[model samples]
Target: MDDAYDELLLRGRVYGADHEDPGPRPGRAYRELVGGPLDGLLLDVTGWDAEALATGAALSTHLGRHGGEGRSHYEPRPTDPRRWDWTADTP
Candidate 1:
């Protein structure tokens, strides 16, 4: 066992087995998704520009609002730059 192994165990303890592991995202930028089917998930926007960030994105998720796979739309909140508000869902 080495430092990587120790980090793996630490990640499991921090995020649990079911939750997504949001470990050190070096050089990667992300925004917290709020509401909709993808709540509590981080949306990676590493290479997005200001225009792209403003336009938002449609994220695919297996947990649809009506109970099937669908796409969730999210837009950056006017008040918060680090969070995206879930606006709608389509199955």
Candidate 2:
């Protein structure tokens, strides 16, 4: 287990697997990724019944400064006011 954990950490550091940017320190990267206004919703996974504490620690470790960089593949849609129609919004 220990060896696996160490290997994982090393891989994370090397590839910035979880946003572990090579230049910055780990704590700063973590805070930048996990913090900010959306932090509440992002961090609140209670409904998933997941292991919050352990997950947090692991994230803090493997994510380094950037926080799970390649783990997520979401791309933000282009922001165009015309794309939204407040008059007839539907789910």
Native-to-model Cα distance after best TM-score fit, residue 85 in candidate 1, in Å: 0.5
RMSD from true fold, candidate 1: 7.9
lDDT of 1 by residue, 1-91 (tens): 4575345333322211235654535465666677887776666677899998998888776676745467888999999766789899887
Task: List, residue by residue over 1-91, the lDDT tens digit for candidate 2.
Answer: 3575334333332213334344323322211122221221122122332343223322222222345341321111134211111111111
- Model 1, runs deviating above 4 Å: 1-24, 66-69
lDDT scores of the candidates, listed in order: 0.68, 0.25
TM-score of 1: 0.69
What does the lDDT read for residue 75 in candidate 2?
Answer: 17
Cα-based lDDT at residue 84, candidate 1? 82
Best by lDDT: 1
Off by over 4 Å in 2: 13-91
Q: What root-mean-square deviation over C-alphas does model 2 reach?
A: 15.9
Estimate the TM-score for candidate 2. Answer: 0.20
